[model samples]
Target: MTRPTHLRIHQFAGLQPGPRLLVTSAVHGNEVHGTKAMAEIARQLDAGQLTLRRGTLTFVPIVNPLAHQLDRREGDRNLNRNLRPPVIAQDFEDRIARVLCPLIAQHDGILDLHSFQSAGQAFAMIGPRNNTGELEPFAQEATESALAGRLGVSRIVEGWLSTYALGLQRRQQRQSDGSRRAQLISDPHYGVGTTEYMRSTGGWAITLECGQHLDPNGPEVARLAILRTLVFLGMLDDAAVEPHRPAQPPEVLQLYDVIDREDMGDSFEHAWASFDAIKRGQQIGTRASGEAVLAPSEGRIVFPNVKSQPGTEWFYLARPSDRVLG
Candidate 1:
């Protein structure tokens, strides 16, 4: 079978049949750590230094080559969002998605690697059990959750769609009076990224944010994550791999709200970083009209992007989730 010309897929098949795993990196052009890690993994496998004991493993080092060449988040638009079957390939990402989604659907597990703009510890974004739309028949929420825990990250995030929907609802609520509230859109079930699409196909998937985009540690994290996943899936012999201890049980965080830049006005009060702690009522930013943007509640700030466009997410607020599973 021929692969898409725009991207590359490095594949390895074992003698014994087993689960099929798809690991992708550089979905965003600028996040190159995962791409580098995948390259190294490919090299090791090619040289016979690493072996797949069972099943099939496919690695797409650069999912968005044009964006990677441009050194931007996307070629034309955010490829991670609005993942659905394309009626027509109208843009660069759309064309790629059309070709990529079908391959993703064939996998039993997926790991989409990424990095953030701000400095922070690595974490895995885990989807909620209830979010599995069509893929629920193939894998259950408990199975996906177990797979996420084995990724060697210290933090796991859930409620991604709920948080995004909350942001949209808040925006609509502000636009309307209490007597005439706008009707909120129904949940699409599928998210805008590779993981969501994979889950929708009944395959377990997780998005690993391997720290800051340019951090040296990012590549290492990505490398280890891949190795850990192989070991976790029993695709590799642990005795043959280097011995390493996994991180302490991860802390589960449930994102509840997101603040968009459009609602915040012109600029932030200060340069905010991801995972910054915010006290209730603290000034987080300033509106164009000189109004202060205060923290709605005491929680940690995540995904704070100072350069985000107006009407797009500026930052997210999250609290410790009571559901902690390893």
Candidate 2:
């Protein structure tokens, strides 16, 4: 199959109109599982095996064409970070965002498929239950949470962009230059990504981290998630797809903080994967300045990236969330 060279959406609408749902993958070029899964879905749709029953379903299998061409994480900059139309369309990602952001706004719900850098079980990232003065003020938390629960994932995480904003604030306080702080203050939507942007546009969205990048099973997860989302949104008949249930009750985690890599020599004490448990006051890594990086509280480590650039997020800390699943 030929690859896409620009932003394109494949849309299918049912005979009777209902809610519009947008499903996207490959927002990050390196994550190919979602792309493969979406391709499979497109093939089935074209073959008349899968049909939308109520509403519209749109697919954007590859969001970042330039990065996908190179098979890298990003081109010029990370497309999933700082997702807003640039005042001047300078880089390729900026121009893509101009087209992608509006397309997201048109949908009622979104299921953004993604894969992570580390080895871990698949999990869903949800927004906060309430708009707590975050950059994105959304009232669709209940709806979003419900959508997340039905995605066939056992673990759900909240507090992504808000916690990232908090980390930038902390960095600003400690550093003399305060570049991160300035960026946040200057851009109210500093940490906004696809889901956050969707929330800001008055739509509910959930990001499903299918599994580790390159995991063969990740595509299957993505495929199931797409079908599950369609069923949950009433776009497809439930009888058309098999019901999915996790082996155990789902666990919800609230990400509280993000640890930044300070220097080139910064490294984790071990090859700590995502969801690795850590105790309060335990040394997780060391800074290039020879300072020990300790956990401020007991929680599971999220996204432990050893290859992170200096001053970028090395890892995140999250604990059990008190909010009940919708």
Candidate 3:
């Protein structure tokens, strides 16, 4: 089936001659914070309170509008996964990415905003394990610090999706040298699955997980997250904004791999915290063996199975993303 070219709605005209900042929200649909924040910021700019200064500002305020309406994780269809130019470019995410990426690249960096499930805390995902060198130019320390200020949390996950995407670009540059037709992963996916795809093509992108989905203030917090990202990317100066800082640093963790179970699916006991420790081979939960089930492996039970949809991950295990950083 063919997809629509422009699901065009309200166009912001020329916010700039070229995009200086690209703030996208709800790429996952259910995550609503970024959209609200972007809209509010747009309103402020219209009100003459905030300034765009030099470069343009672009926003895909509701990237996956269909999925956002449904409050689902993926688009009712999978528009995000296939981001390459030729293959069904009209699909939702692909169309938006096509329009969004080049515009974002016109600027210094991008601030792709996001939020997480209700159980999770707010943190910024910064990555590419080895690409902090490149990120240094894009995301200066003051900017990162300013982002930490707005997020109200100091926990920054290194080697994030965009970081790794830049890492892949570095690899491609080394191989072909000055060839734009280099062989590169279209959507740079780290072991972290869906989110990192934009990093490779979208210059510097970060997935800012802003608290729980159901929280009344999640949207507002998510908006601040985008501002912080802008500050870090140098689009916004630190003195212009005030970011709330969490006492001490946020405990950062590496996202290992998502875990899944078949029969009776993965489960856990009530009230276990996200970073809680578990013993090797300890029986954390069970599956219906029609008998006695067993624990699979050992690490610490990560993202844990909660009472929700069937296939939406039971749990995940991780050590840390920084431990391996060079």
Best by TM-score: 2
Of 1 and 2, the candidate ranking higher by TM-score: 2
The candidate with the higher TM-score, 1 or 3, is 1
Clash counts per candidate, in order, are: 1, 0, 15
For residue 219, model 2's alpha carbon misses the true position, in angstroms, by 0.4
Model 3 residue 261 lDDT score: 43
Which should have the higher lDDT, number 2 or number 3?
A: 2
Residue 73 in model 2: lDDT: 87
Q: Model 3 over residues 1-326: C-alpha lDDT tens digits?
A: 34334533223434345435566777678877778877887787789776655455667777776677677766534444444344555435655666655554454445666665536566666544323454323323333334444566555665333334444454434434332222223234323322344444434455676667776777777767666655554555675467556666565666554443434554554555454566666666655453323344444444464653332245555555444211
Question: What range of 10 consecutive residues in model 2 has the weakest lDDT sum?
Answer: 180-189
Tens digits of per-residue lDDT for model 2, 46-110: 89898888888889988898788888888767778779877887668888988998899899988
* Global lDDT scores for all candidate models: 0.78, 0.85, 0.53
Candidate 2 versus truth, CA RMSD in Å, comes to: 2.8
After superposing candidate 1, which stretches have Cα over 4 Å from the reference? Answer: 1-5, 130-139, 170-191, 240-247, 263-265
What is the total number of backbone clashes in candidate 1?
A: 1
